[model samples]
Target chain A: MRAGEIAGRPVVTLDTAEDIAEVKDVVFSHDHGYLVGFTLNKRGWLSGPMKETLDWSGVRALGPDAVMVASGDALAARDAESGATGDAEDVVGGRVITDSGRELGVVTDLVVEVDEQARVVGYEIGGATVEEGPGGDRRYIPLPETFAVSSSALIVPASVTGFIRDDLSGFGSAVDEFRAQLEQTS
Target chain B: MTRFAEAEHTPVYSKASADEIGRVIRYVVTASEHTVAALQVGGRKSKALLADWAHVVGFGPDAVVIDDEEHLRHPDSDYEQRVTAGELDLRGRRVLTDTGYEIGALVDVEFDESTGELTALETDRTSVNGDGLVAIGPYAVIVRQDAVRPEEEPPAS
Candidate 1:
């Protein structure tokens, strides 16, 4: 699933079935390669931001309808003391370049492997490297088993260029093949 | 049960003197307890006056009766100060669930006349049972997710 789609989904509590808050933004840890947590806002229009944040561990289920939690107590004050910093938007628009010095594209969105443990498995890119048209066509590039990511650029192995897929439907296998190739080369 | 709208603007009287003191204006709520902490009394030519719910003798149909005019005082605590400043009044505030769904705007509140305990929170679209209330913040009133239901749906099991 695209991480952006989860942005506006309501955070519902399983125990009381209350829609306590709405997802304001998805927080992703590029260093850890997984969802970190979410910044929240009050549900109604014009409602102000919430002080507490919902950590990824507190999420019971990331369903199509809502982000489920055990109860309102699942939300906790953001720990500024822990240096917790991750806003998924920081990665979007960053240049996607290979370690071999090939500039592929600019990141458009994150492809999340949705499950009990949802994680970022690939990135959707759109730029001159993907196509030749006026609006460069978008493509999905699998992430290597290990890679370096920063707010400015993502450095993947050159082998990733060959595994880029046109869409997300069969992107899973491409990721698997790309990982296998990297393991074999190492 | 008495709707806040029905209580508002009603004349307030002192049981000890049987003299009219002021009119009930707004309720100062203790959000955490889901109870009315105090009543903002006005309509007299003086500073903003408040009577704690504990001092209220009765919420009569035609008037509100208090123990004495002495119970009325100036807003003191930070919470009461906020309430007196029109920042913490529940009426017209948006109602939201903990999950962040917008239920509706709180139009009125129903409470037990004798105990000052809230009975229900009424919005244009639905009525939430008082027990589901979580917090009444400056931005919105937060309730349990299951507590919000479509006007037509049966209460959740």
Candidate 2:
């Protein structure tokens, strides 16, 4: 699923179609460099109005100013292949397993990049600094096309789970070394 | 050359309270000042603080921010460890709540680039957006920099 960078653009759907709020930010994997779920901000008229954010699962289409979803009906409007979303205030915590079965540290938040045009790049994962350290590690887990929202779990394809467990050492000094170089050059 | 520029004489601004100069001169610098020929420095804030800064008009980039010293150190939380890893700074940090307790790190911060204040943080966990999504602000929540912990198995450093 994707949340294109459009400030107030609204996502639309067919019949029981739900409006996939504008893609506030997109999550991407720093390790593999792939598009993940998007962070959306529900449109509102008043200030301090509640904003909504959903996983990339609901999205079925992506357009310039709008995105179409598979189905975003009522309360159960929740379904994430990423697994478990208690709410924006509370997210399902635990390390994520990649499709390759690698360990991707508990997903912490979403990361986004916007250009001058306000165009958004694909979303990236915001990994927590768990019992991990030193930039921890980054892995891009596969995302299912859709998932059923459980009371606590977002419910994603096992294909993703299979890979969320690789050895964290694979990133060794490689990540750090690269980061050092980027800082030096920039 | 810039004030305190490559010169033989010692700099006075550095010796004086740069913070005070900043606090007193914000009106001219932040509000608008084309050229500052020999303006004095303030010692109100810090020389570390820049004269010109950008503001975020709307949603920009996501960044991790640590506010309230209370949250910095909790009863049974290792938040300090996470802060170091995320390299968090108040200038651009993401704020998050963990099961009612605000926790987590900020891996990335978003800015309007144009306006540039700090729109949000690229959070680590996907929290409930209250409505039906996950995000820190308009920005996603990022892992606390300190939370980037050491490996289960230490390498031969």
Candidate 3:
């Protein structure tokens, strides 16, 4: 599932069955390919953003309908470890550059591996760098296990260019192969 | 429970002299304790008069009863000075959750008439339980995220 799809999902506490909050944005740790947590908003129309952040470890399940947690206590103060991380929206529109200094394309969306763990696996690229092919204006590039990411660009290994898929249908296998290659090289 | 609105402007009487001293003005609240610390009694000609909550004999509907006129005193502390100037009045102050969301502005405060303990914080849209109150600052009243009840969910299909 795309990280964008998770935004606006209600966060429910399994113990009380109370809908405590709504997901405002999915914060991601780009360098580690791990989901940090979700920034929340109060659960009502026109309710503004909340101060508490929900860490991924607090989540019991990320169901299609709602994100489930053990209890309302799961929402906590944002500590130094999870604080200041970028959300998925921050990565969108940022440049995706190869480690070898090749500019690939601008990031359009983030593909998350929802079943295994809610981790970012690939980037959906669009704009001038995308090839004219079956995927139309977008292309999916698998993320290496570790990479460098700044506010303006994501730096991936140059070998990632070879594993870029046309769409999400075959993106999982591409992610696996890309990681395998990185492991072999290191 | 009595609302601050209902208590304001009510006449204050002295039990010892059996004479009316002043009218209730604004309440001096201690946000940390979520209780009324004192009462600002005005409508008198001399300097500002304040009656600590401890001095209040009863919060009757007709009037606030105090032990005597001596119980009323001049504003002594910086906190009391702010209260007398209407700086710390909770009404019209915005209510913010500890998680950083501004829910609404405080409309009225409800408290126990006998003990002066806060019972609820009311906004135009909702009422937050007093137990969830975290702090009341000059800028806004901060509360726990769960203080305001969430909107009822649409029935599941």
Q: Whose TM-score is greatest here? A: 1
Select the stronger candidate by TM-score from 2 and 3: 3
For each candidate in turn, the TM-score is 0.64, 0.22, 0.57
Task: Give one digit per residue, the lDDT tens place, for model 1 in B21-93.
Answer: 9899889877667788889999765678999999999898999999999888899987788778887678888
Question: Model 3, B93-143: lDDT tens per residue?
Answer: 866554445567899999998998989898866778777777665556666
| TM-score quality measure for candidate 3 | 0.57
lDDT per residue, candidate 3, A120-143, as tens digits?
888889888777997698889998
Question: Which TM-score value belongs to model 1?
Answer: 0.64
Lowest-sum lDDT 10-residue window in model 1 chain A: A127-136
Q: What is the interface RMSD of each candidate, in Å?
A: 7.3, 15.5, 12.2
Flag regions of model 1 displaced more than 4 Å: A1-27, A37-90, A95-105, A111-124, A127-147, A150-186, B150-157
Where does candidate 2 chain A have its weakest 10-residue lDDT segment? Answer: A114-123
In candidate 3, position A134 carries an lDDT of 76
Across A1-186, the per-residue lDDT of candidate 1 in tens digits comes to: 777788888887755445789898777665556777889989887767899999999997675556878779999998776454557688889999998999999999888886656678899899777785443498889997655578899988998989988778889999899999999999
Chain B TM-score per candidate, please: 0.90, 0.25, 0.90
